[model samples]
Target chain A: MPKYLLIMRGTDESNAAMMAGIDEMIATTRQFIDEMVKAGVLLAAEGLDDPRQGVVVDFSAETPVVTDGPYGETKELFGGFFMLDVASKQEAVEWAKRVPVARGAKIEIRRVPGSDEVPQA
Target chain B: MGTVDVEAVWRIESARIVAALTRFTGDFCLAEDAAQEAVAEALVSWPVTAPVNPGGWLMATARRRAIDAIRRSVALRDRYPLLTADTPPASEPDPDRIDDDLLALMFISCHPVLSPESRVALTLRVVGGLSSEEIARALLVSVPTVQARITRGKKTIAAARIPFELPVADERRERVGGVLTVLYVIFTEGSTATSGDRLVRPGVAYEAIRLARTLAALLPDEPEVHGLLALCELTAARFPARTGPDGSPVLLEDQDRRLWDVSAVRRGLAALARASTRGLGPYGLQAMIAATHAAASSVETTDWERIVVLYEALGRVAPSPVVDLNRAVAVAMATGPERALAIVDELTVSGRLAGSHLVPTVRGELLARLGRRPEARAELELAARLCTNRRERSVLLQKAAGLG
Candidate 1:
């Protein structure tokens, strides 16, 4: 079965706005998680720490460059995610649509194929 | 061999190679023996100097070993397709058309001549490509016991002269159930243990699912094949919630449905749809029952009427005391306790499930629901005494205490 990582991203302004109303957002999100749990689709749900506390390593240069977060030129902060083992991308999209987030936040759903998907020699 | 993952490659390719060997050599025992010998030799050498092509290396080595063994066997009795020590057998069989060989291996492993234990062990070893140690640990049996069963199973096939070919049409339809039954038993062992502290044997359960998927691919037209797959997948979807954090059994009503695997539910539903095309078989009916619970928001909201109907259908297809008992439970939930009690009372009178705690336990629950406190408490107490599993006994004891 394939697993999907529902990545909810927002700009710093959006993040701050959501945090300002964090209690209600948290309540709605918990309700959303409860729905997923009842449907038996939720594998895990976790929130990311402040992006300022995160680090970024750049390998594009010959020597690796390690930069502390609030990474430069970063458009959106990739926040918390809900990992679900669901049937299709469409199903994942439906679940993602129900995520409670700030107005400016965007969610990206990525599928993780099984290790068996790698072709053998 | 520089850090080659020999075990992983063997896990994926072992069945195909062994199946092909059996087809070419026309000797099931020799083919399996040779394949193991090849893997054993690779395990010794691969870590130090890995093969450029691991699967190919194993295949060539196994064929060589089979030829050598045939030479020695020729001194006693003639075995066809005998080759000289240095020669490769006439020509390589095409691997593309190897599904028949796999199906044949499955049938032979689950041959009626062998005992149930042997069938499970043999299927895990050959078809599932599991190590004896892995099988033993998953099954809670000793490695020697697993090895003995595999060895005895192969001997039985030889003695019974089970042909290395798929059973003919009529026989194939009849015997596929025997093969599916072996996989089902293995899956049941992993998903639900009757006794012991371990509530779930994930390794065995996952292996059974992998094998079932393989069978479904091999016999795409067989509805029961998909039925077993659906049944296993749907039942396994609840595994995450089946046990609590402390590894204690969680009853169905108390389980957190949010913990179910959504992808597994989808997989099961798809398989169930395929199963229904030919009408619900025994496993399909069970899968339907599982799906009802999977889709339900809670016990109160569960479609008990539909479950009762499904169980009734299951009773007709695979009539057993357990099925009848399950139907009665559904009946109790759907309508009332009186009718369910009548069914349990009939079972009690028949003595078909004499030593099993299940009958008394169900009867106790129904009795409690009917407000027969004294009798319900007594039945639960008797059930607690009869139950061999510690966890189950604890639940029964709790029920009896609740009645009191």
Candidate 2:
């Protein structure tokens, strides 16, 4: 019953001041992903293409209206995320606390709804 | 052939068998003595028989030795009635019960009555199963120092009559931090020797890391356990790159990206993720900061801003001058040297890092950056004088010379 989605702001700002080459960053990111897979905590995790590719969907209208990507302020934008199944909320929090992010960058922890249902992309 | 090789392997495997025996015998001193006797027998026999199940054989033989010793000792007759009245439990044959013994021995070794140094030595001896000589070599201290620590440690535990069983949940949480602290000190000593020829002692660090991993496995539900594991893993990942070819200290900025342990970093990140399932404690926050560096390919690319933020959080949870000094560095990297220098100067005036060489070294760097060569040289010379490590002193002196 313990499922969690760890959401945080992306690396767009942090990566802006790249004194180190991007190739190294990409490689490190890949290595981090490989580690998550090996540990078996990663149900699904991915870096967004950019906030530009994202969109907001509203169901309040008769038909679903899709807003353009990068809809929110940069500080509030959804960045990267991960989903995991652990033994407890405490376990989930432990995992979230380790994510590489700016100190005050908010990490939103939400229990996945209808976890038994087929996972969506 | 040599006792050192045999002792080294025994040190690695000893805690498990000793812990198991303590549970069966319910006598800490007796169980430990029996284990040592069995090891002595192995030294003589293994060069001949070389059994495959050495640990198992040791546990079985140690139990028998404990039984025999109990029968011979009239002094223990009243105190250890259980041992004198009956044959050793047939249940000792089961290897699975070793877990309980190990848990009990861990608690006893880390009992609250002992000082942190004694706790570390005791845990390494009883729980890690290291001989005094091996531990002495590892710590780079004299054999007598190690012997004194273990003897004093055991006497303290016995005098206090600390229980031979792991505490319940609340008590476990209270003591677990102390236990973890010992392991951390051991690992840190290995990673960066307080005073030694080598920059890193892989053996000590690896032993401590292995112990932390074992504890993490034994207590899978404990968030702090994972936090410790994460911290060790992430720190260990930098081991290969922390030194130059000549064994000189490699500043974090100068370390080669390829030398870092990707696997250890990954393991650390995973552990950090697990730790996050609980509220961010000091260790977890520190691990998170390490993760920022782990995720970066080079120092410049590291998420210094995020690291600074984590340090601020860490300061709240574990307020130490050392943590503050580190945070100052991160703040400087994220913001500017001017800001970081301000903080360091404040710390200096407050006498937070009065005797520490690090504060002066950092101040020198900031002064150098600000184009104050004469002042920077003076600070570097002061740092060199205060620093204990020969290598660090050399670096500070070299920097001072360069400034001049």
The CAPRI classification for model 1 reads as: incorrect
lDDT digits (tens) for residues B1-404 of candidate 1: 13566666666567877888887778899999999999999989987887776767888899889878877886423654444434453255443456678888889888888999999998988887778998898788899999999999989988887889888888887789999999999999888776677777666777788788778877878998889989988988888788776777789999888878777888899989998998989999999999999999899999999999999899999999999999999999999999999999999999999989999999999999889999999999999899877777888899899986
- On lDDT, the candidate that comes out on top is 1
| Residue range with the least summed lDDT across 10 consecutive positions in model 1 chain B | B81-90
Clash-forming residue pairs, model 1: A37-B258, A38-B258, A40-B260, B1-B48, B1-B49, B1-B50
Give TM-scores for every candidate, taking all chains together and pairing residue i with residue i: 0.76, 0.73
Chain B structural similarity as TM-score, candidate 1: 0.95
Best by TM-score: 1
| Tens-digit lDDT track of model 2 for A66-104 | 898676576655666888644346556655655655434
- Predicted candidate 1 versus true structure: per-residue lDDT over A1-121, tens digit per residue: 5678999888877898998999998898887775454333566799988888989999999999998877675567788889975545655765676688888889988887542244334
lDDT of 2 by residue, B1-404 (tens): 22223454454457766776676666777877888898888888877776655545676788779878877878665546665455544444443455556667777887879987788888778766677876888888888998888778877877777778878877778878877888899889888888877777766886677677767756677788789889988888888788776788888899886777776788898888899996878888988888898889888889899999899999999998888889889988899889999888889989988988999999999899889999999999999999877777888999999986
